[model samples]
Target: MVEIKEKGEFRYIDEGEGDVMVLLHGLFGALSNWEGVIKNFSSGHRVIIPMLPIYTMPLKKAGMDGLADFVERFVETMKLDNMILVGNSLGGHVGLIYTLKNESKVSRLVLTGSSGLFENSMGGSFPKRGSYEYIQERVEYTFYKPETATKELVDEVFETTKSIPKCLRIVAIAKSAQRHNMAKDITNIQIPTLLIWGLNDTITPPLVAHEFHRLIPNSKMRFIDKCCHAPMMEHPEKFNRILENWLENEAHKAA
Candidate 1:
């Protein structure tokens, strides 16, 4: 647990060493969300987990800053170069934005249940299907097993929601719902990219993955069974295997 707040109010956790792998969590999520997958990933890669600035605040309004700029500063401040960016859900959106802006810094990109994508050309507006109830519905769609959406899961997500102040939550939600055409930027990105989706995820849905696979030139898509918005958490073993295999393939290709 390495803490460095030199860059705003963010602390970075460093684990393992080799190729740098930066992990960013989704909305209502902090760095801790990666606790389950980090150990498996750390054996062969340096993992840098950052606590997002927006979520770190208690009652402050989420800023209007674009995801790309935030990532640029975060990477520059950390001095991380030639790294892979892995993001889940909202984190995926951040990773995509960052990669689009700083292509040279990323060796590869992987997104699990990422959110910065849409099926139609309309790139703005908060998800009408974003409320807690809507989130539950979306979760049902993203996970193949309905049992996964148990009361415990609901409570866990509710707790996560409560962790953030209402003001920041509203702002973050609003920013996400609003429009911005990141797809155009992704289309020009030539870096290696991987899109992982939970076949059951209704929030972003598999169609969102299809959109990314369609736009991003060098990209591939994989679906995790019985998982929803977070395959890395719900199905860590499968997630790790796929991630390692992809990394290995990337290494061989680079060599």
Candidate 2:
């Protein structure tokens, strides 16, 4: 276990043996967000989850922050090579950007309700505002089923928001939002990719998954029934099964 700072924020990280798998969390999410997923994978693979620093503090430097650079620094700092990338929501978007910019580091890629893939897929992205209420509303939209949207879920997100200042949150989104066209960059990825989407996801809908599959070469899409944006939390068993199957197949193909 090791704790390190990249771009001025502390991130918790753990390293183990087997094929390396880097787990990336969504916007407003820290490494803790992927705790369950990491537990499941760590038994079989080396897992590394980096806390994205951009979404932490309230104040930030001006202009769009370099997401690509952050990823580069992370890879170099960890001394990682030839690994699979698993990212959810905004993390998925970041994973895609990192792979696109540094294809040499990635082996296989998996994205869950990934944000960076589609522009108009989910009734267009959220509005260009930074209010806590506005952010809360947008965050709520990421889920597929309203029934599954509970008070606890909303409160958890609220807690994360309260931890980070409004200004920094706005800057992170602003920089990511500035380059919303992930489709154009998909062609750059050479590694085989897997996309898992929630069937009920309204934020990044099933249609977005299909579009990503259609655009990215050598990519496959799987939709989990009754799940929304956060499938790992909403449906962990099914999500794990899907991941296990894809990984096994990828392993066979490589052999």
Candidate 3:
């Protein structure tokens, strides 16, 4: 069973037991993005999915550094030690930044379709009041297989984007990403790292993953063919299998 708990300004889903695995979601996403893989992961490890403050409930205007600071506080608040941080998109970026600052606290790192290393080609212009068609187009852009952009998914995202406040929040996040550059600091990360990418990801693309692999000395990269930005959602089974194997290898080495 997944138990929801609120700690200060953040809300998180806590489930299972053993060494901690904290999953972070990207922009326009919540803990549910990991729903497909969470059960499998939770069976063997404690899974904690925290709702990022800026994304969910912004206390103030924050850039990447501010958001990274929030993640640090969340870790301290949860008393998490030697965590395996798995993040997608914005979440992955935050995880990378946090791990760079607090290397000893992270046992391993997993980044999937992460941002922050390079400037996004998808410019920062967002509609003030997005229509269903507009929202659908944006959602469809994330997927290489257009069929994966189901009506339900598009509608869900559309509802969220309809809110003016949410739109503004998204703008804030885009600006933060534009100002921060993690590529220069990625080499400083000393923890075991894994980079997962969807082979057809147009948003971040496979080249971004290659750069991450090159920068992090002790890192490995895996690509899911015919997949797009959200592989954890689009190809959970394969994604989970890769993750399970990597985690097992890391554990063996540690043992």
Predicted candidate 1 versus true structure: per-residue lDDT over 91-205, tens digit per residue: 7877877776678998899988777665221122322322577546534443567665665665555555454354355456446534544776788888899987888775677
Colliding residue pairs in candidate 1: 123-179, 124-178, 124-179, 125-177, 125-178, 125-179, 126-177, 141-200, 142-200, 142-201
lDDT of 3 by residue, 96-164 (tens): 889989999999999999997763533334644657777777778888788888888887778777877
**What's the lDDT for candidate 2?**
0.72
lDDT digits (tens) for residues 41-119 of candidate 2: 8788888887765554334432223555576787887788998899887778878878887888898999998877553
Candidate 1: worst-modelled 10 consecutive residues by lDDT:
119-128
Residue pairs with colliding backbones in model 3 are: none
TM-score of each: 0.80, 0.81, 0.93
Model 2, 117: alpha-carbon shift in Å? 3.4
Best by TM-score: 3
Those runs of model 1 whose alpha carbons end farther than 4 Å from true positions after fitting are 1-8, 56-67, 119-165
Which residue segments of model 3 deviate by more than 4 Å? 55-60, 119-125
After the best TM-score superposition of candidate 3, give how far the Cα of residue 153 lies from its true spot, in angstroms: 2.6
Q: Which prediction has the highest lDDT against the true structure?
A: 3
